[model samples]
Target: MRNMLKATTLERKFPLLAVENGCIISKDADITVAFRVELPELFTVTSAEYETIHSAWYKAVKVLPDYSIVHKQDFFIKENYQPDTERDELSFLSRSFERHFNERPFLNHYCYLFLTKATRERSRRQSDFSTLCRGRIVPQEIADKEAAAKFIEAVGQFERIMNDSGFVTLTRLAASEITGQDGKAGIIEKYFSLSQTDTTCLKDIGLYPEEMRVGDDILCLHTLSDVEDLPGKVGTDCRFEKLSTDRSDCRLSFAAPVGVLLSCNHVYNQFIFIDDHAENLKNFEQTARNMQSLSRYSRANQVNKEWIDEYLNEAHSKGLISVRCHCNVMAWSNDREELKRIRNDVGSQLALMECKPRHNTTDTPTLFWAGIPGNEADFPAEESFYTFLGQALCLFVEETNYKSSLSPFGIKMVDRVSGRPLHIDISDLPMKKGITTNRNKFILGPSGSGKSFFTNHMVRQYYEQGAHVLLVDTGNSYLGLSQLIHNRTHGEDGIYFTYTNENPIAFNPFYVEDGVFDIEKKESIKTLILTLWKRDDEAPKRSEEVALSNAVSAYIELIGKDRSVTPCFNTFYEFVRDDYRRQLEQKNVREKDFDIDNFLNVLEPYYRGGEYDYLLNSDKELDLLHKRFIVFELDNIKDHKILFPVTTIIIMEAFINKMRKLKGIRKLILIEEAWL
Candidate 1:
């Protein structure tokens, strides 16, 4: 059987005729046009985005019924380095210092699309003659211009669909050219060269093997009985296993056995051949009829009783449904030891998943067949080859459900399930223009849920993107993050404000710069004062509230007229005590009716020599808007009766003022223990 299989698997090579814009024409006049697609950067893609991408592909295939589409994704490992080495050198003591501290491995992804046009009968006959005569391929131009135009239009439609979801696609220019030692030649040479082994040559037009030595491995599906329930989404169900013994200090986590190959550590290459739906349906109908006939014959003759009964029962249990698809899974590695390890690991994973896989011993023909179009004879199908078709095609590797934000500002974190570093963008959420909504986000979780850790990580990313971030917390959760950013920016970026009774961080709400006291600021100040003075279920009388508002308005006007006068809590208190009372007397309003003495007593603690006097009287020391990151630690003041809410209100008002001042700059205000 092996000898027969070998004889039947003759290695046939095709010559390349000419390379033109957008398409690669083979000697047999088969035109395969290729385009490169850029996958969106996202932590998890939303369901809507997924449906849109899927529908786009479906529509494209539906429009071009005669053309065959091949979608390919290639993932490779790239060593991480400082993005700007010169900038790093200026900051570091030496180049070696920077490399020693900041180098790691991350996965780089690339996606490509190939559309092959249907062959003409005349071209096919001529190609068969040329092959028999051992002559060059006859040059033939693509005859159907309308079909080509339609293909381009379909791609444009897809781009528009993706763009709405924040994904952009561009045409990969000269996709048919190969880059190597010879420096850019027709891709046909790499595929048709007789001197080199087929495994060493590049077969695909858009793909070039630069990082890893050019080679391929043929992974055949030996068993699928274990795949009784395929997941609705595409990705492996693997957990992260600790790679080091010291869990406390070690930061390495790798996927358990099988997942390592599919994740970023190793790359999995897939080539899927989708059969015609109409033909597949026809074959399934015929198979169903044959089964019915066999069942009737078995019951009538009682032949192989037990086997026949099991077959009939199985057929009755599951409805007749099947899909025709041929998939070739391959993994490439430059090192021989690594390749062997990957092959063994892949087999083990398949077994673990209950779907057995066999490494093809006839590597040359199998790998060659994977890249060639309309060549399915190399790998024959078995009875269990067909599967229940899914609504959406699976890419094997789980990707982010939605596209990443358009801005190139994010950090890569390891995905808990796949153990692949996923890019999490924290710059800004992409929303349609004219939409009115709050961008504030809340993180709620039980203890040890990594809420603080996640916030610190996100804040760090925002700072890296040049956004000003202010974090107010009761615990010292951000101290470590602050120090890290401070060191990286050479003590020029991050600032920490720790508020304690003995050494309180001063913030005068009434202190405003000249020309900066807009009505919004004044309103925010009044709101803060009201929050401080008004008790729950104890509303201040309307007259007293009006008096306070008039005092605040008069004080703001006073400060605006005279730039030298600094308005603090004392200034407002004096104005309410003397000027406000005198005006009320003139209006014939009695002091006893307004309860003026109580309002003065409620506000006296925030004045001179009061317990909270330091906060309301002192000048502001930190510029919240200028610094990249500022953290106000309220650990010492969290339990105070009056200070907690007052400090929080002050901080909130200050941040609001800063945001108002910096209109064009993006700012983030994160409040931990916001309920307090």
Candidate 2:
């Protein structure tokens, strides 16, 4: 046993030495600066915007010095939603909403970028010389302090270039986040254990020729290491047909198939090794000459020479920098059956990108070691294919999963790919962040396309968060939700009124909760009466308009003085019939100028015992202001001239009144399929 070829442990071959001041130092004189990458949400960026992100990456990578390694590692781990049910302030629907998502599994993604400056000797090392294969560790001295300083400065510039694009943001990782504390695992520890959570305990790692295993989970890796396996022509973005139509194209990054679209617990590692441009060109030129010399032996050699010449010509003419690039997807599952399914899923996803998936078996350990946050210098060069910076950047995914809004006000939405519930703020947060100009939203779809369904979902959440929601829907789309709220509040809120022969929708325009009539309130009341009395084509006479305004003013004044008299259309009609007629007679107004009898008869339907006598005298006026969810369903009477216009005016007046009383509160008025 002692003679078993000097058994070496992972601790002896680990490439990283220590983390200091938020930087990772390696055993081979490599220093890596780490950052957490925040990308735009999936399905949100357009084709032009994708080019901006790609250009940002291209420019950012151009700022780094020769022999620098840029490694972007994205972890898509399966996680469950942990709802906080302990909050006491949650409403009944809100608590149920939270519970509905509890334990719901989703692929949680976290992206990281590592900028590593490797020593010249280490930069040129091959796969056989990786730390995983070497038992004796030889530490390289980092003698050039100025080079490290310059590299850090260049990294800072790289960050600025990416951030200034306004689409991508990079945040520098803190020391604690890189190398965590007692209970939490750091970035390096997480890689070693293949754990998604920071609080996971370190587990044992087993490496075999067939696969790699971390505790109970077995790994499956698929790599795009050779140019022969990649797509013939790559671009900044591709058309995603799952969420796109022929008329409307949805654009995503070229490598999106292997990104958030690939569900499961996985990691995507992208590497671009920036070697000396002149040196790589010289080597390629030398290789092309060799291929030319061997052309007499085989036609393949002639073809290879032509390809190399084109590469050299493009590099020299276009001033394109030569870089070595590699990308691979690593997935794992605890059950063998699930691991097989994950392997198939990964392969199919790669196939979706028009690439032949190569199931990588060997070099798994070394590749995993190189992905250690700060140890990017230890990556195997043999696994990478040579490409230009622009083409290499095309393979980078520019989007991530939708993150929940931090603001308290938002609607509950599901992620398109993951189906994870996301707290999305389509109104306030977008306006606050300057992402949108206003809170106005316009939804367009054919029938049965869930247009009203989405609006119902939105308003329900709005109502739960102390918002006053006034819905004027022609159909009964909001009936169930309004009923839910109505039952939950026990008839105190969520008032839903639909026109029926037995019981019609009604409201009191004259009743204000606070009994204070501002100019706008009085004007709204006047507009309601005007809408009721005159037809759409018939314009009221000037004298009649003035007389109606005076009557409303007089009734408002009488109610302000006397608390016993109710402030509704009944009292106002009676005051106009008996008291106002006597006043008109005293003023001796002529019958042609002002007809009191005609005015009373026109508005008499809303009076005590007429056809719509129950319209304006509402006992529910006080609670209307406090009601958070109010739906006026006019499906039956939307075509009726009297009920439709009158009901809309009354509901709108109530909304206006609520807006005045509830000063800083949120109020939403959604009108769907009205007058349809």
Candidate 3:
């Protein structure tokens, strides 16, 4: 009767375990905790049978929450100390088993849910900042202008068709399609398939079951944004998660679910997209294996006939493959070559130690180029390019080591491409008469460094070399050089000074294209006139500048480049005056009430471009100093804006094509403070 009662009770607690020693539940559940166990409990019936209890129960308990408790008795009465044959053992076992079984599913469920939420949260933080920006939409303001009206109309049309949540929903759906199971599976099979006969299923989700057999750890590989396409090529569902988006070139981390670190080799075949990633690990193993295999095949000074010789001979039979392998073999053939050469040579040694001459025992080329001892007499006569260069130019040698070898030291060549020959006397070097190599030297010394004294000596040297010296007396500092050259040479060959008084230097932007016009260039004659009148503050009224610019544009079309014929400038001014006359004739405006004098009153409203007034613009001119020389000098004219065009045009018109016309004339146009 008791047996029947106990059996009935046991059956009620776990229906699946009644016929077997244990029950196994295979349902999927959310695993919330950080760890897990395969089995939850064990039970034994007798005192001695307690030994039959498996350790798995104890191990499983280790993973449970700290608050959980286990009891040794159930249906507690005041003092029931039953022995193992004691009813208490069975009671304790039963209760413990029941507790573990019930809690296992709950723990698994929570763990699963925890992981899912964590993964989603991690992915959200990786998205671009632009996604967040869309949440903060602002209404744009529109003005009453034509451009603003068009912008408003466009914005309204866009608002009518679009809703606020549309962008978010589209992005979510797109992401889902990209990471779905079928998509992941196809990509994996495409990249990792090794055999023609093995069929890969589309439901695997880019993850081969064999690759994720581990339950303990995960492996992650990171790639830059430029390589995100790799996951698709590899047939995997793994994706790049952005590390940082604040930078323009963000890198993403790709997590690969490798279950166990030890099983890397078994799943190595899955690395199909790039062999390099897998090869590095494989190479390390291969290299270790090869070295071990090589040692086993070689012993004492003899190669193992069966192992080493046979393997090498077979490899050498395949022509090109043999040649390549032979090179490697030769590289390792140091026993017969390098060691042999080292033992035979001694005279090659350049250094001695402890009063003993050290002999070189190797034919290996010493990487060292040359070294000269303190005794210059000991230098080699059949010198290397390095040594010969040092000897010829009397340069010092500094030893530098090269490559991996230590025997032959290296020397750095002191001669650089920019360095001049050190020891050779400049007087001994050949020279051509009347041809001077020292063109000009700019002295950049601090004040009180005798810069003027040095310059005077250089000037005297040039004069002795037959150069006609022309010293510019800027700041009046070069008067001494001028007097020296004057005292040395007479007539037109001597120094001369030039000064001017009545040359009116004026600057008027109204007479140029905002002062960029070459006044001598009649092509922009209208621009020059307008610029001039504007600077004079005598510009025409609002009706004037507009009417004038329009008429100028038309006249330019009428005459074109042919406007240089003198008739153009006269016509432009005539057209300006006549336009106002015609406007007065039509009664469109009045000239008497708003004459040129009163025109300046409303001058600003009519101005088209920037405004400026008349000032003397510096002009550059080349003054003929001698038969073969010219001095360029600059003076102010109407517009400073005319600096480039005026300087360029004047130089071109006066000296360029007209050089041949000046008979035996040497002209030099000198510019002072030339950057102006």
RMSD of each: 8.7, 2.3, 38.8
Tell me which of candidates 2 and 3 scores higher on TM-score. 2
- The TM-score-based order of candidates, best leading, equals 2, 1, 3
Q: Quote model 3's TM-score.
A: 0.19
- Name model 2 segments beyond 4 Å from true: 1-6, 619-623
TM-score of each: 0.67, 0.94, 0.19
Cα-based lDDT for every prediction: 0.52, 0.86, 0.25
What's model 2's lDDT at 246?
73
**Per-residue lDDT of 1-676 in model 1, one digit per residue for the tens?**
4443221111233434545665565655555655555654333344455555554544444444333434343333333534334663233323333454354443444444455554434212321233323433354566777766675676555445544544335354364343223444432333333112223344322122222123342222222212333232332223223432444322111112332334323333333334454455565556556656676766643343443354344434664223323333445454667766766766766554434465544332334333442221122232113443332234333342232345565654554533334455543433333233556678999888999988876776666656889899778999988887788879876777787557777777776555467777777778767766778567777786777677788888877788667678877778778877787778887775676687788778787888677767766534455677888898887877677777777777767767778787778889898875
lDDT (10s digit) by residue, model 2, range 1-676: 4564344567777777888778888888789999999999988899999988998999999999999999999998888888878999787777888899889888888999999998778877888888877877787788898989999999999999999999999999988888888888788888877765776576777777778888888888899899999998999999998779879999999999889989889999999999999999999999999999999999999999999999999999999999999999989889999988889999999998899999998878778777888878888888999999999998898899999999978888888777788888888898888878889878888998999878877887787687889988777888898888888778888788888887777777787767888987888888888898888998888988888888889889999999999888899999999988988899887888878888788888888889888888877665677778888888898788888888877787778777777898988888886334
Q: What is the C-alpha RMSD, rounded to one decimal, of candidate 1? A: 8.7
Give candidate 1 regions above 4 Å deviation: 1-14, 37-84, 88-103, 118-324, 334-336, 352-354, 369-406, 411-423, 427-429, 432-438, 480-496, 524-534, 557-566, 575-587, 619-628
Native-to-model Cα distance after best TM-score fit, residue 552 in candidate 2, in Å: 1.9
Arrange candidates by lDDT, highest first: which order? 2, 1, 3
